[model samples]
Target: MQFENSREFARQLDKEDKLSKYRNEFILPKVNGKDVIYFVGNSLGLQPKTAQRYVDEIMKDWAELAVEGHFYAEKSWWDYHERFSEKLARVVGANPAEVTVMNTLTVNLHLLMVSFYRPSGKRYKIICEEKAFPSDQYMISSQVRFHGYDPKDAIVEIKKRDGENNFRTEDVLAKIEEVGEECALVLIGGVNYYTGQVFDMATITKAGHDAGAFVGWDLAHAAGNIELKLSEWNVDFAAWCSYKYMNSGPGNASGCFINKKYHNKKDIPRFEGWWGHNKERRFLMEPEFQPEPTADAWQISNAPILAMAPYLASLEMFDEVGMPALIEKRNKIVAYLEYVLHEIDKDVESSFEIITPADQDKRGTQLSVFLHGEGKELFRYLMDQGVITDWREPNVIRLAPAPFYCSFEDMYEFGQILKEGILNKQKV
Candidate 1:
């Protein structure tokens, strides 16, 4: 698909886009009283227009039924989270029973690690990618410390080779084999937050299992941004937040996936709560813990219905369009964005590098641009020009043209603004 640096070309693509109508479903943020070009869905997704209605329904239920809303409300607060399982299961490619909405991402990661990260004797090491999200790095370090092992010794970080921006899949697999006998867990982000590289999860999971390790993924950037097959990949577990890409509200409840193979295994250690207990005997208040025979068994508390409403609303949209359609639009739009960036570089003589994988299959919606000459100042200029993107430390600016809302015209406009920003720097 050859792209031209013209608004007409962009608008023509928009005219052909099947998912263009979805842009209307979201309420775009304004800059100078006009909708800003939002390319930061990797950091935070725009809010769904229906979000208010969903929350209002929950509020109305609480107002009218009060305590009885647990069972009496239209959606029933008692099982509010269940409404998302089937739809979310499709989103993550898992069995309905294996997927469940629960606590936030890091919290779920800790809970899952409790069950999947068990170490004994000499096999206590954990393998993860270097420069993981700060929370994950902290979690791994703390979990290792909690298990009475020094992080420096027990945690192995796989880093990119010198002069590279991303890790090679073969190198990652080799590292797993290198520590096969000692590694107990292999956890990594499905789509790396910084470089936007999408790891080969299926191959990685197989390699981890052959190495006798439990493998998990933090899909914080992968979910809703790329197609995932957690169950088919034979992943031990996975977790993701709903705010980014999924377009749920800020600090919204998260989704969890536990392979069906672990569903009926009561021997798996977990931090359980009453919500995870056997539902039939839940109100009976049994002294002994009887776990649910599903992924919900890992849940430590009842559903946060109010917080989950926006996610339910967003999932409805996902269910309507399905991942296949979304991925189709994502590929075309992101390719257009890539084309625009290169065009801008060619026209403006800008010195910046795209750190993201060039292969569409190896990335999601995000493209991390590492500015070379005037990095921070160019980023600030784009921001002042109403290009809503995010700046990472050192020099990278992350732009995620989300398929659900962002248009081809937006990408074209961004290219123009980026060129202007760089050319303006030359004048200075």
Candidate 2:
């Protein structure tokens, strides 16, 4: 698909887009009097228009039924989390029984680590990508410390080759083999947050399992952005937040995946609560903790219906469009975005360089641009000009052209704004 660096070409693409209708479903942020060209779905997705209705339904039930809402509401509060299993399972490619909605991403990571990150004798090291999101770095370090091991010895980081922005799959596999029997776990973000590189999860998972270690992913950026096959890949566990690509509201309930093999195992260590008790006997409240024979067994508390309502609202859209259709549109949009950026670089002789993978298969909707100079100033200019994107430390600006709400026109407009920002800096 040859892309032209013109507004007319972008408008033509938008006119031909099958998913163009979805753009209207979200409420875009306003700048001055116009809807801003938003390109930060990797940070926080725009709000779906139906989110309010979903929240209001829950609120109305609470107002009318009070304490009885647990049993009497239209959607019972007693089993609210159950509603997400089918949709989330489809999104992550797992059995419905293997997935469950629950606590936030990092919390789920910790809980899962308790059950899967068991180390003994000399087999205690964990392998993860270097410069993983700060929260994951902190979580892994703390978990290692909690297990009475110094992080320096227990954590093995897979760093990118010098001058490369992403890790090579072969290097990662080799690292797993190097750790061998000492590797207790292999955990990595499915889509790296900074460089927008999508890891080869299947190959990584296979290497970890062959090394006799559990494999898991933090799909915080990958869940709704790319196709995943957690169960088929034989991943032991995975977790993701709903607020980013899933387009759920901020700090919303997250989703987790546990292999079906682990679902029926009673001996597995976990932090449990009443909600994970067998539903048939939950009301009995007996002393014995008989866990649910599914991924729900990992739950440590009751569902927060209010926090979950917006997720349901967004899931409905995903269900309607399906991942296949979404991915189809996403690929084209990202290609166009890349084309526009290249065009800008040529036109302005700008120092901008895309740090994301050149191969479409190795990336998602995000394109992280490394601005060689004046990056912070250009980012601020883009923001002031109503081109919404995210800026990371040093010099990168991340732009995610989300398929659901972002249009080809938005990408073109962003390219124009970015060019202007660069040229304006040169004049100054």
How well is each residue in 1-428 modelled by candidate 1, as lDDT tens digits? Answer: 77898999999999999999999999998887889999889888999999999999989989999999999999998788888889999999999999999999999999999999999999999999999999999999999999999999999999899999999999999999999889999999999999899999999999999999999999999999899998899999999999999999898888999999988777789888999998889999998888899898987789999899999899899999999999999999989998888888787766769999999899999899888776688888888888999999898899999999999999999989888888877987
Model 2 misplacement above 4 A: none
How do the residues 50-94 of candidate 2 rate in per-residue lDDT, one tens digit apiece? 999999999999999999999999899999899889988899999
What Cα-based lDDT does every candidate model obtain?
A: 0.92, 0.93
Clashes of each: 0, 0
Candidate 1 segments exceeding 4 Å error: none
Candidate 2: lDDT over CA atoms?
A: 0.93
Q: What are the TM-scores, per candidate, against the unseen true structure?
A: 0.99, 0.99
Clashing pairs in 2: none
